[model samples]
Target: MSSFDETQDFVVVGSGGGSMCAALVMRSAGKSVLILEKTDLIGGTTARSGGVMWIPNNPFMKAAGVPDSLEQASTYLDHVVGDHNDTPGASRARRRAYLIQGPRMLDFLIGKGLKFSRIAQWPDYYDEAPGSSVPGRTVVADLFDVNRLGDAKSLLRPNFLNLPAPLEDVMKLPHVKKSWAAKKALARMGVRALVAKVTGKKYVTAGAALQGQMFLAARTAGVDLRVNSAVSQLIVEDDAVTGVVTEKDGKPWRIGARLGVLVNAGGFALNQQMRDQYIPGSSTKHTSVIESDTGEMILEMTRAGAALAQMDATIGSPLSLPPGGEEWPIKPGAQNVAAAPHAILVDQSGVRYLNEGGSYTEFCQRMVERDKEVPALPSYVVFDSDAMASTMIAGTLPGARKPDPWYEQGYLKKADTIDALAGLLAIDPAVLRKTVDRFNGFVAANKDDDFKRGARAYDRWLGDPFHKPSETLGTIGKAPFYAIPVIPGDVGTMGGVVTDEQARVLREDGSPIARLYATGVSTASVMGRTSPGSGVNIGPSFVWGFVAANHALTVAG
Candidate 1:
């Protein structure tokens, strides 16, 4: 092993949102920081996500006239994330720390030149829960000009969609009435791109934009980033983490840190062995996270006496894999399409198991629950031609005149009638027909007696606003029914090394490991098994990163 001569004040082993936040803070605090990323790209799964942050009472929310308080946010967390606090890794203190410091950290980042806008229409996952907000406490990053980063932009991970506007603007595309308003939006976007190109700018939006902004901020703060370096082990001295050994260029290099080592290397979503050992389902091929996240840092920390928690949990969702068994670089889940109107999910028995309009996480959880009784390994999303023509389905774009490749490849089954479709799906024809008839009755009555779909504000938000009576409940009466197989996929695994309120990694005895900190998916998620809102995954990550960096800075002083 080759040992590096230089010693930094802090060493961050990952380049996700959490590590970026921590590196920014440490650099701002005038500390020598080194960021080591295993992959060539700088951003991790954060670049693949929606890039929204669920920061209750954030300055953006306040500016938008959204009412929120710490107490109210605490109550909401208590209601949703209750009992999980009693678990080994989760605690009430960590939850409070997340809620209290989240907005402050976001505001700090905003002050450091990160632009964000409030998502006023996004509802909390459980809006009916105590102290929940109808309009969520989520804020998404504004579109960023990646040209500001110049050549550095190439190092950033690409998002699922490369739209050159904010996500809010992108969401309006489906609602645009094909009139001048729609033409104007598209024209404006094109003009913006043209202008940006003329001005030597490259604008990116959503998660890509968020990471671009963060990269710019970190660069401005003079963070030393080293990509293609994977941390192999933590260097411990007197029971305190002092450095790390990284594998780079087919060699091992040891680097020292004066303050601490922050483990933010993400989860093991792509690791099949870990998934099989922890997650409920057997398949590990369909995660929505980047392939580089294989829990290396978590394993290093665990070897150094760190405790683990919430190992069985994941931010699960239902996803339709690509045809011909070809995997994309980044797999995008069919979340919105599955929740859209006229689409009903059925088990192998051709029976509806849960509300199709529920949150993606809950939908996957229900699939897992149903799998216990029946072999619902691959659930079917049954929809009609109207749904296929009116909106996107299983990644199929709207208004596509031709049949999808999935249909031609047999990944999607289609028939002129529900019974025929069920026959094609190898399901009981009578049961599927009865299920569709019952669902149509529920749509006509504007009430779901079976699953209570479209009852919550969140469900309605994901539904068709133009549909009468209910947004999420519409009849699947149109001919040419279609069925697509959906498997349990995850945004990322949520469990990892356990940490305390200050983001310090802890031992099994609940004692902190000195000079060792963790943030993001490297540690047990503070949200536990519940996802409170759209950005819950990223919100606490930012806060904990800030907390960890500040604490390490104090130690350095």
Candidate 2:
């Protein structure tokens, strides 16, 4: 606070989902809050993401009569994300804090007039785990009209879904050809689109909607938010973070924080150098994060004495790179479709390794781990011609015309026989035939003994719901086999500077760095390496951010 050009009670670096949450907290406490975003866009990856917050025992679940309790959620987490010495960020105390405070965080935000509702049917990724919520605890913001932001809408980050659809309808529409309910859902979406067109109101959904509401709420609360303001360094004094050095008029601008400086920047997913250094075999081109997510604050935190952890882990999203796919920031993830009926992933040697229908996070993790044993970096997703009649492939739905180049350039490898298809991928024809035949056997038995593909509700939920007998159990036969090469991509890197229950960054010796805090992907995740549900990353980021701001207020008091 001393000898600074400008100051605020709280200075948050990075305008991710957690940044606004913390700002609202400080403003609620009648303290001056400043949010500095490094990119021109106001929201970070959170705005472009699905924006679902997996907060168990939330009021949304209660309203829908979906039975869930803190104790049950805790048991589920304990089973899926067991306490590990390596993942210090997910310590027992931290896990308990998230469970006890997440519901409270939702209530607090609701009290401030930021609306939210849960996806009544989004199951936990590990649905078979003890105490898991079959009716998921996924909270999402309502579709927001961007016009409400006024001129500030221009500064908001763009979402992938140009015309965003409701989560419920999105899940249903994928099965439109096969399910009567899906056809109805499609009709509903068309109506919603028509109404918005007539009303001249531009709406954004998913992460965009979530962040839009948060951004509007923050502005209304009188929190000072700035874009294109990058904090280049943490100005530490006596091992305590006192201020930050950003830029003004192309010169150094010193901004001090009285209560604390929170580092919520982002992860190192988009920085290829950092990715290679931390998580090898990762490609910046493949990460789904916004290009601005380059992990600048992570290095700054380390310079300020913050200890980093979980550097080798990532929320693995299996994606395929077509010819010219590098042009797109968010490539088409193959995880969901690859897990659908009639499709199964295989190694270069044409051997099936793990369950095709399960947690996308686990799916990608298996690919990464399996790579160490065999050459599976660009694994083949083999499916039959029957799948093409129904499956959605790389953003292309059934009967939709794909770019001719997709087939001409070998992106869509197809042949009349399994042997021919395997030959296209340089895989052994007999090995692939055996693998497919074995899979078909499981389909006949309605059982996947190798990986338990359709054994869980979550797995079935992600499959083609209209498939008879079992949604995920369908034969890969019927001639003209096809395959696409898939590799491991990531939504965000799993590791960063480690923080404690208060969301205060800790040192290697296990002590909190004074006045230094972090949340979001900037800190080591609360679920450690495992993404137990849809919004584990975003949810923990918000909870810890809220916790940090409250802790700051107490300290200031």
Query: In order, what lDDT does every prediction score?
Result: 0.82, 0.88
lDDT for residue 382 in candidate 1, whole number 0-100: 90
Q: How close is candidate 2 to the true structure, as a TM-score?
A: 0.98
Backbone clash total, candidate 2: 0
**lDDT per residue as tens, model 1, 1-557:** 33565689899988887888998888887888899999999888888788888888778767878888999999998888886544544588988888888887987888898888886588998888998888789888888888789888889888887777678767767756644555577777888888887888778888888888888888888999999988888988889888998875687788998889988888888788887788745455677778787877777788999998888778777787757432755554665666778888899999998887656777788888898998787888898887787776555567535456766788878799999999998899999999999998988898889888888998888877777677788789888888888887778877998898899999999899999999888888888876788876777777898999988887767
Model 1 vs. true fold: TM: 0.95
Report lDDT (Cα) of residue 215, candidate 2. Answer: 92
TM-scores of all predicted structures: 0.95, 0.98
lDDT of 2 by residue, 1-557 (tens): 35899988899999888999999989988999999998899888999988889999999888888998989999999999998999999898899899999998999999998888888788898999998998898999888998899999998898877764766667677677678887888887788889988998888988899889989999999988898899999999888899899998889999999999998899998898998888877788888888778888999899888899999888888898778886687788887667888899999989999887677788888998898999998898898876877887877787535678989999989889999998899998999999999999999999999999899998888887778798887899977778888998888988999999999999999999999999999988889999889898899889998999999999888
Report the error of model 1 at residue 395, Å. Answer: 2.2
Off by over 4 Å in 1: 1-4, 177-184, 247-250, 400-405
Clashing pairs in 2: none
